[model samples]
Target: LLCQILHCLLILLQLVEIVLFIVDSGCSKHMTGNLKLLINFVEKFMGTVKFRNDQIAPILRYGDLVQGAVMIKRVYYVEGLNHNLFSIGQFCDADLEVAFRKSTCFIRDLKGNDLLTGSHGTDLYSITLQDTNCPNLICLMAKATSSQAWLWHRRLSHLNFDTINLLSKNDIVTLHAYFATEGIHHQTSIARTPKQNSVVERH
Candidate 1:
């Protein structure tokens, strides 16, 4: 009778442990699912507003959904300082012609400072006309020109005018020249090999 009672008690304890483990695991899984759902819901809600301001307005004004799509794509897709500096007005006759005729033009930093001495390069006249949007442009310009060579190199290295698609051949040429002038050249230290030199030479 005593042996049978002890065996029953051991079996009961094992079952209780197994049940508790299962319950804890299930609870954790449930909590994780709930957290993920909440995060997704919040992201969707915020995206709704961004979509209207950045997407819908441009579509209504332009009348061409494709152009609107391109604009939205550029606004979202392009990374770094130069992306925000470009806009629809850039297609206008005055801005477009100036961008083409002057190689040195549009070399100004966001703060309206000339990137090169006036004798060497030109500043974008339209940039001054964009004072209303200055606050945003200022932020981007500051970031790009912050560490002169690095940002300048990055801009030149990945020069994709496809999004705005208005930069002329001259614009590209001038930018390339400016980068060559301002970029830092890193020199590699030469290591001497044993085969090329006397191994037992004394100084």
Candidate 2:
């Protein structure tokens, strides 16, 4: 009877050991899964950080600068035109000139016409100066389409344009090419001038 009792105790201890081993294995698997998830998250976050700093922020800053400079120049030109018109007895108050100037000024994706008539365009120019993940100006321009340009402008109005004209030809080309390729497909309302669309027919 004593021997039988000893045997039973040994079996119980073995079962307990087996149970402990199973629990340990399950805990190890859970830890591995958590580590994998953490690693993936870190990788994605790093990629986004690199892109924002290297590409998106600079393009946005440059775009804002260019738009601002253009706005100031246009304002001066409009003022001169208004003065000339008034002097010639065109019968126009300065308010009209101010309105025209405001209309022509491109701010937050609203073009001159949009400001004048509240008829917003399908696309608006936008830029991000700092902490942007995507630096490609073309991609930024492409985002300013009929669907989301207005919303994006509303979100990013705080950005300032300091010296946008200094952007290189390559950057401009990149933007223009993107517009030509993608924008052309969507711009059915924009009729090209005959000279602009002329093509030589194959003989």
Candidate 3:
């Protein structure tokens, strides 16, 4: 009876749900309290994490978050954690690029396909896992595989991707040059991405 009770308590400690996932540069690894969000969960002791308040939470299990095409590999389920965290470092470790801008955050594969996008809220960036009727943060960007790349090219009048990229880059520079010519001082978003427009339109 005592062992069963302890097992029940362990289960309770390992779960919480519908969490807001924060894109955190400060968090060293992916973490969540909700075991329900994880697929292929493996109980593994990976030491403990100390919070800002100095409370230590034991790392209870290892799991991967599989949301649509976006799979955050090998996340740790920390006991009693209140929020889900995606680590910039962890993304980089998997050869993914993490970008933060004035109002946008993006995770892209090396081929420049966006895996996920999030909005900047105050200093924290939060992402949505599904495209439901939930406030903001919906719509996962699908990867344009090489097989489908030609379709995109044909759709754009056979305009190659490199040329499209150049056009976008040059368009931004041209706008900035115009701003400078008019003596209108301007600040630029990192990488000068025009991503905020898509995010706005989606929301």
RMSD of 2: 32.2
What's each prediction's TM-score? 0.14, 0.15, 0.55
Report the C-alpha lDDT of model 1 over 1-203, residue by residue, as the tens digit: 32232222211011111000001111111111111111112121111112313642111111111111121111111111121122324233122221223432333334554322211123332221111211221112222323454555464455364621343342423433533465622223636423336432222
- The residue-level lDDT of candidate 1 at 99 comes to 28
What's the lDDT for all of these models?
A: 0.24, 0.22, 0.70
Ranking by TM-score: 3, 2, 1
Instruction: Return the lDDT, model 1, position 22.
Output: 9
Error of 2 at 96 (Å): 39
Arranged by lDDT, best first: 3, 1, 2
1-203: candidate 3 lDDT, tens digit per residue:
32232222211111123457899889999998877678788887899999889999899789878766677889999878888899999999999999988999889999999998889887789986742223342222223455765554455465354654564574522444544565645554545534475531111
Output the lDDT of residue 103, model 1.
36
Stretches > 4 Å off in candidate 3? 1-19, 131-203
Off by over 4 Å in 1: 1-139, 144-173, 183-203
